[model samples]
Target: MMILRLALAAVISAYAAAQPASTSSSLVTYIFGDSLTEVGNNNYLQYSLARADFPYYGIDFSGGKTTGRFTNGRTIGDIISTKLGIPSPPPYLSLSQNDDAYLSGINYASGGAGILNETGIYFIQRLTFDDQINCFKKTKEVIRAKIGDRAASKHVNDAMYFIGLGSNDYVNNFLQPFMADGQQYTHDEFVELLSSTLHNQLTTIYKLGARKGLR
Candidate 1:
């Protein structure tokens, strides 16, 4: 499964690489997902129950210090960005709005977050798909302020947006006997809800200026 996921991520990176040079250089990368794509957004959440800032989490990373990535080293997001010849965007929570790094887009994923806001409720704190998208909106505002509306619009449209989500909604929410979703709806109904919710969220991103996306 890990190998498969890496292969798919590579496809997106390759597509980005194949983009015309004029647009490629201006392309920023944004990531959203659960542990598989999470870098360090959860580390900055004061009360976040899902965290990876401890020993063994990043033993393979440089300096052997944990950076909130769930993997032993870099997450798929890190690998994809490095392949694209750009630094992986930093966690949105880790940067001040005025920081120059804000121009490079942001990673808004949380380790336990899911498409449905209630999916990770037991974790006490996780950024749902809604929360991550909201952060992106704020990110756009910051970029607009720095480069003006027209330029920012163009930059955002040129950016690469990646999302790895949904599995958790089933693994951690719908199938969890302790959760009400399982009791409230049949499996088919739940699946439909998940699909529609994801479609709507992706549409929201498209309307917000994201033109190239991979999931």
Candidate 2:
């Protein structure tokens, strides 16, 4: 975990440094992923072991209370937002649909989530990548309602999307002894499946107005 944190920090720093000096502050940021980039989405889920909303998880954060992050402090999303000069987008489940916050961005990451719905079936319930995109579609509606179609269209198109996925697809699905994905598909076939799924997902988001993106 410590090594992962260090590597993530280095990546964030380098990514931030590469951004243009005069980047627009109006640039929105939408985040999606699993435990690695999750904020607090799983805390709202029922019957899921993929929770981080407990002691020892936020020992290094301000207030010293868990914020449902999968680490001791701020997530990569949070730090990257700071580096980019934008407020961290709040967790999707933590915000009301009617809230004006959607104009900025939202985080729809869940701790046990993956590209495939069955990746975290052992957790009973989780928001898969498909589910997250569906939620983002709803967010888009709200943004349109608040800002009107033209402006909302530009906002979404100009916004940056950050998705960190696939880890749980290995940790909870491909590597699980009881899971059938491995038995049903060879490693190469599994990679192809994931590739096709991701390509379709990216295409869906593009049709919905997501342009500038990162993953």
Candidate 3:
């Protein structure tokens, strides 16, 4: 009887220790980007021309509430989060009003945002990579406040960061300039510019402590 009680206590202690390990390994994914990844930040920007707060966008999502996700159903981030056994992140703007459920994940993506500082043609608000980084920094602070330093560090290190932005640069910046001048940059030159800008943005994130990142 004594031996059985001792073994039971050992098993209970092992289970308790394993709980944190399991959570640490549970893979937290943070998605950052433009309209493609903008789950709903545009909705909060009242004067911004990049608002998607309407139907048909979330027709396939739960309850069919247009959460400002640009895709007809789910963006790549949504699909990836579903695969990772977690819910898709909420927009950074929405974080203020929503409950703690969304504090764990954050989306800093905004419509018309680009890698270059001046890449968008929209006369309204546009988010450059620099602006996105600022939002990300703010979100990190909130995460730290909510989850503490250790869990926040684990989340940043283990989370998969997805960055998808560059399409707008081509469509809104390069194409328009080329059409106006009747002259176009060589494909290599365009690629070089995009690559250089992307590299700088990525380096900023790395310096900010993003360990697992994807672009």
Q: Which candidate is the best by TM-score?
A: 1
Clashing pairs in 2: none
Cα deviation of 207, candidate 2, in Å? 0.9
- Which runs of model 1 end up more than 4 angstroms from their true locations? 1-7, 16-25
In candidate 1, what are the lDDT values of residues 1-215, reduced to their tens digit? 24546667878877867867675556688888889888899888889889999999999987799999998899888888877767888898999978988787689989888889999788888889999999999999999999999999998898888888777787889889999998999989998888899899999999999997765
Better of 2 and 3 by lDDT: 2
What does candidate 2's lDDT look like per residue over 1-215, in tens digits?
A: 23545565577567677878678477688998888778888888878788998899988977899988999998888888888778888889888878888988899988888888899988887789999999999999999899899998998998888877887888899888899998899999998988899899989989999987664
Candidate 2, superposed: residue stretches over 4 Å from native:
1-15, 18-24
Candidate 3 local lDDT, 1-215, one digit each (tens)? 23533453355334435545456345565676777778888787778887777767888878788888887788766765654556778777776732574346677888888777766646377567788788777766767787897876666766667676777776777777544311456767877878887888888888776886544
Error of model 3, residue 83, in angstroms: 0.9
| Full-model lDDT for every candidate | 0.86, 0.85, 0.69
RMSD to the hidden true structure, all candidates? 2.2, 2.8, 12.3
Candidate scoring better on lDDT of 1 and 2: 1
- Please give the lDDT score at residue 105 for candidate 3: 65
